[model samples]
Target chain A: MFASRPVVHPMEVAAAPANPAQQQQPQGVLMKDLPGMPGTPSGLALRVTQFLLAAVSLAVMSSTSDFASVTAFCYLIAAAILQCVWSLSVAIVDIYALLVKRCLRNRRLVAFFAIGDLIACGVIFSGACAAAGITVLIAQDLLMCSENHCSSFQTAVSMAFMCSFSLAPSFVLNFWSTAFAYRVVAAG
Target chain B: MFASRPVVHPMEVAAAPANPAQQQQPQGVLMKDLPGMPGTPSGLALRVTQFLLAAVSLAVMSSTSDFASVTAFCYLIAAAILQCVWSLSVAIVDIYALLVKRCLRNRRLVAFFAIGDLIACGVIFSGACAAAGITVLIAQDLLMCSENHCSSFQTAVSMAFMCSFSLAPSFVLNFWSTAFAYRVVAAG
Candidate 1:
């Protein structure tokens, strides 16, 4: 059942060589080792994606107030969806490295990192939910204004629910990552 | 002039045990001899603080639409003050240890956590500025409405700034923790 599993160290899986000398060299001559920077390519990509998402979110907020502006709303939704995808990708990669690769050899490091990942995932998830909720609330507000039959309290409740729901995903991610990290670290 | 400095390998410093048992009772002890749970004190305290802060933020958001009423708005000032205290304490205790004691003792972990701290500080600073701007905008709106000169652009700007600012601190905190945890895993 586990015939294809790789016996990789957790640290090795997480640590990508950042020093140019340690990178793939031309035609097999041993390159001199140098101090490497931290963070993997995936991590770097995620950071860039996060920054882009933040920028798009800011731009959307600045450009529109009416939720009915489909273009602006779509932009916001796109940025959020992108964030979710990035987060899930990271989570999946981490899990894969831990499981199939048996890469979680260093228990301490894994535990710490897992906790951190969980928290980040939770926050991002929550933010997404909140964004969606806000959109719905705005739509409801517009509808209420036109109809003059809806209670403000209902809108407030919806907003609260939305914000809380959005926060939940990130929190769950954080918890899961932390638990996994702890197990790895303790095992090591 | 440099009498106080002790020469030690960075790896040794980075991997130093948090528990005295790991250091002092190694011959008689197994890995489990050390406390099963690490950083329990700090972890518990942090969780409590986070809960309280979250509660305050929720209350503030629920009470008023005025940005000033948001607990996170106040936290900008609080975080600035806390940053000073934390930074000074870190310096006094050995910056490396302070940064990575509870997380893990690795250069990558320390660096990541430091970055996280910096991000959190930056978010708080920016949020405070945005909140101040919001207060000003609110005042302007009140004056304009009384004089029948209110503009939607001003409202849009205020909302944009507030939303942007609101997201920063938590976002930074999330990423910071995640990155730090990942480093811990890598280094472990």
Candidate 2:
């Protein structure tokens, strides 16, 4: 009976096996029987959805502000650039893990990714807090001293700091979720 | 032989069994033997660390802002209030979940809590993004229109929105983790 079934390797198992019993098998078994696809459709769909939501959210946020000012535009450009770098770095790290099959270990890589991601989140969060703080301070100054008395240079510096602070949490959370997803994928 | 062994209920199990053989038992078996107790000391430490880190991160971010006017103080206060609310809400929800043993069965309450948590994460994310966006806009306006002409009112609004947006994912993650921990406690 065992011989007739053939000695199939674990990796061939399909992600969504035809039989639920088969689906419960280990990853190696699934990988062996299943085709070696570069990426799973479900994973791709999830990534696309996350990207779309992020884009929409960012767009909505940007729409609320006047982008025509050079200072504002420069800040926006810098933020955009930073975001790109942060996201790409995460993706690259994930890909590297996947390629190496280190993802299978459920090991320290998850923690490493988590730490890196959190640092990024911390940066973003810090930026936001600083911006909000500065905004409040500037508004307070204006209310107290009149618009002419408010220091523009000081205010600008404050805004930059606030924006950076606010974004810090985001990077942390992103790292956390990515690590979580990686664990799930590896387990599956 | 089975009957000879003491019929300890699942809820009586505290932490992992000392026996290596029993430690490897299925989660269901482990849960049946141990009722909930204070989680491992390490887990508690981790939670405390996370809270402190988050607080420090927020503080650092606030310090960076220029706060030229009294209005800036208003924004800062608002941001602080929101953060406090968000954090407290999470703690409250966690406590409630623990007390009620909501982690056991799949129920409407769990779903409701999950949704609420997701919304919170969204709020956090949105706030952060908006703060960054507003900073850029303010900088631009300052450079183009002069110090007196530039205002970050719109950016402030955006920060509020972004703050709301960022809270969702974290909420979901926390809820699930707590639920899992509950199961672990119940099973042991």
Q: Where in model 2 is the C-alpha error above 4 Å?
A: A1-75, A89-105, A118-188, B1-118, B121-125, B128-179, B182-188
User: Among these predicted structures, which one has the highest TM-score?
Assistant: 2
Clashes of each: 22, 110
What TM-score results for chain B in every one of the models? 0.32, 0.38
lDDT of 1 at A92: 60
Stretches of candidate 1 exceeding 4 Å from the true structure: A1-76, A87-188, B1-188
Give the TM-score of chain A, superposed on the true chain A, for all candidates in the order listed: 0.34, 0.36
lDDT of 2 at A76: 37
List, residue by residue over A62-169, the lDDT tens digit for candidate 2: 454332333333343344345446555544544654566433223243345445544544443444344444444445533533542234423443443443433433
Each candidate structure's TM-score, on Cα atoms with residue i matched to residue i, is: 0.28, 0.36
